[model samples]
Target: MKPLSRVLSRTLFYLLVIFVVVYSVFPFYWAVISSFKPSGALFAADPSFLPLPFTLEHYKSVFLQANFGRNLLNSLLVAGGATLLSLVLGVLAAYALGRLPFPPRNAVLYLVLAMTMFPQISVLGGLFMLLRQAGLFNTHLGLILSYLLFTLPFTVWVLVGYFRGLPRELEEAAYVDGATPLQTLLRIMLPLTGPGLVTTGLLSFIAAWNEYLFALTFTVGDAVKTVPPAIASFGGATPFEIPWGSIMAASVAVTVP
Candidate 1:
């Protein structure tokens, strides 16, 4: 009886894990497979799980006709710029907030977290006005700045937790060695917090890459448009027709990275 119970529990655990994995990854798998199918095969009576008689027509359309290559480049530039800026400012601010002993320190940290709760729509109009007044509207700089509203708080909050978890003995040792605060942060602290830095920077990059509202509102021209808005604006020859094949191909292409 005991052996049967153990076997049953193990089987159930494996089944649950398999179900979760398939649920999470199946959409991406389907998208990739569908991207390779020809337009006619996409809407056939019986759709196969795999791309039989695979074709590159959709990929060709996305690059040659839709100009997604340019859109991809734009997304890379925006996401990279936002991540770099966020990391620089966030690390400095986080180090100060987490390490320095200051009055109202808890209040300041709470205030930063509070800023993240405000809805984007609530601030969009004000941001638009500010960007226009600063001559940054419809520009890469504008999009980067808008992304900072969300990314900065996330980066700072995550880094603050990481910085706090680090041992004080190391900083004290650095101080005993006649190291200044800046030197300690640069040489001792930053080196030890590599994993935290990578985690925060990757999250910030993904946020900026997938952002839609700010990207759509800030930029107008194809020259500056990122992947999300560019994908939304994809069209077909006729008003009634939807280009699902090309759209799926573009989605798969963008998602690969």
Candidate 2:
């Protein structure tokens, strides 16, 4: 009876894993198939798992009509730039906060944590005004800078933990060799925190990429817009109709990477 019960539990666990996998994957799978389906098949009463009557029309429409390539580039530039900036500043700040024996160290770490708790909407108006004053509005640079507000704090918080986990003996060895703090960070500490950097960098990029409100509010037109707002701006011939197929295609494009 015990052996039978153990087998049942294992089977149930596998079933749960399968359910979670399908639940997470189904939406993206549906989008991929929907993107290839013809307009007539798209809204048919009976939808298909396979794109039975497939066509490239929607994907072509996305590239040809929407200036989507430019939008993709803008997103890349903004996300990549923000990630790079966050990692650079995050590493420097983390070293100071985690390793330095300065007073107010705990207070400063708590302050950084508090910054993350404030909702983006709460800061949106002030950020917009500040960007406009700096003439950074309606540009990729503006978007990058705005994203750093969110990304930088997260990067700093996470990296501080990673830096704190390193051995003090390593730093003393570097110092014995006459290495400066910056040199110690770059040569001794940064290499050990590689996994932390990659994780933080990827998260920062994703946050900047998917950010919608700030992207929409900060930019005016398609010329400098990123993928999220650019996709939102896509429309059919009339106000009542939406380009579902085009949206699917665009979603799959952005999601794959």
Candidate 3:
């Protein structure tokens, strides 16, 4: 009876994990295969698991006609810039908030977390006006800066926890060695927080990459657009026609990175 119960529990755990992974990954897999499907195969009421006639037509269209390559580069720049900037600023803020003794640290941390709760749309109009006034409209720099509004808070929030988790002994030892605070952070503390940095940095990049509202509002031309907006703007020959193939192709392209 005990052995049977153990086997049953183990089987259920594996089954649950499989179900979760499939649920999470199925949509992307469908998009990848769908990208290769031709218009005929795509619209067929009954679609195959693998595209019946795999083709590169959508890829060709996306690159050759839609100028998606440029959009890809722009997205890469914006996302990378946002991630790097967030990491740099976040590390500094985290060290101060988490390591250095201070009054109102909890209040400050709560405020940062609260910043993330506000809807993006609530600030869009103000950001638009600010960007226009600063001559940052329709530019990569504008997008990167706008991304920091959301990314920086989350980055700082996560990194603060990481910084706080480090042993106080490490900092004391560094101080005993005549190391300055910045030197301690860079040489001793920073080196130990690799996992946290990578985790926050990757999340920041994905948030920036997948961002559509700010990208659409801030960027006027395809030249500065990111994948999400560029994908949204893809069109067909006729007004009534939708280009699902091109969209899936663009999705797969951006997703592969």
Candidate 4:
């Protein structure tokens, strides 16, 4: 390529990278800044980029008035439970598909992938009804199961690729030495796949934490509301106003840790 063309390509690539980073991070930065400002400043027409003076009133109000502490705990429990279950099931399923293939393995994998494509909203009413009937409605179990509908498939796929990339000779050798397949899997395969497991677990946890539709549909009371729905349901200080500062504070809190 010509020097000018190469320079242009480099410029374009840098611009694209910068654009993507700003796109993802700017909202987070803005939220954190806004959260520290008072309500008037948060909604200022000429918003200041730098929070010259910061305050924790919003955070205090969120914790004290909104009962965000309890809601946060619920979110932690639901997301944690879902991520754990999905990680365990995803690892086993991915292992079977990647290493110990059974008949029609590809077909089953494709079906699971297809199931992930279905919109979560499409099944919301049915899920709500089923959970209500089973007395799991407004419960942590319901939210965790609902989140699994989103997390499990991608986790399985990620783990499958990671497992498939592994050296299988060790596992076969283990089995030959009278180690059961489960033993080989637990003792050998899992250790080799730690990074991939961590990656998938993080993705699953983020998905469950960010999920909103199922949480809203299944839980109305404080008993089951998670962070997303709790942050969303915020109305302003005057019964009907939007508590923009508190909402931003809660959002920053959620994104931080």
List candidate 3 stretches off by more than 4 Å. Answer: none
TM-score of each: 0.97, 0.98, 0.96, 0.92
Which pairs of residues collide in model 1?
Answer: none
Please list all clashing residue pairs in model 2, or write none if there are none. Answer: none
Candidate 1 lDDT tens digits, 14-118 = 999999999999988888888899878889999999997799998999899876888899899999999999999999999999998999888989999999999
Residue 78's lDDT in candidate 4: 96
Task: Please give me the total number of clashing residue pairs in predicted model 4.
Answer: 2
Candidate 2: regions farther than 4 A off? none
- Candidate 3 lDDT, 1-257, residue by residue in tens: 99999999999999999999999999998999989999889989878989769899999999898888999999999999999999999999999999999999999999999999989999999999999999999999999999999999999999999998999999999999999999999999998999999999999999999999999999988879988998998889899899999999989988888
Candidate 1 segments whose C-alpha is farther than 4 A from its true place: none
RMSD of 4: 2.0
Task: Supply candidate 3's per-residue lDDT for 82.
Answer: 96
Q: Which RMSD does model 1 reach against the true structure?
A: 1.1
| lDDT of candidate 4 over 72-169, digit per residue (tens) | 99999999999999999998899898889689988988988898988987988898888899998989998888788889999998888988898978
lDDT per residue as tens, model 2, 73-164: 99999999999999999899999999988999999999998999999999999999999999999988999999988999999999999999
Q: Once model 4 is optimally superposed onto the true structure by TM-score, how far is the C-alpha of residue 228 displaced, in angstroms?
A: 0.9
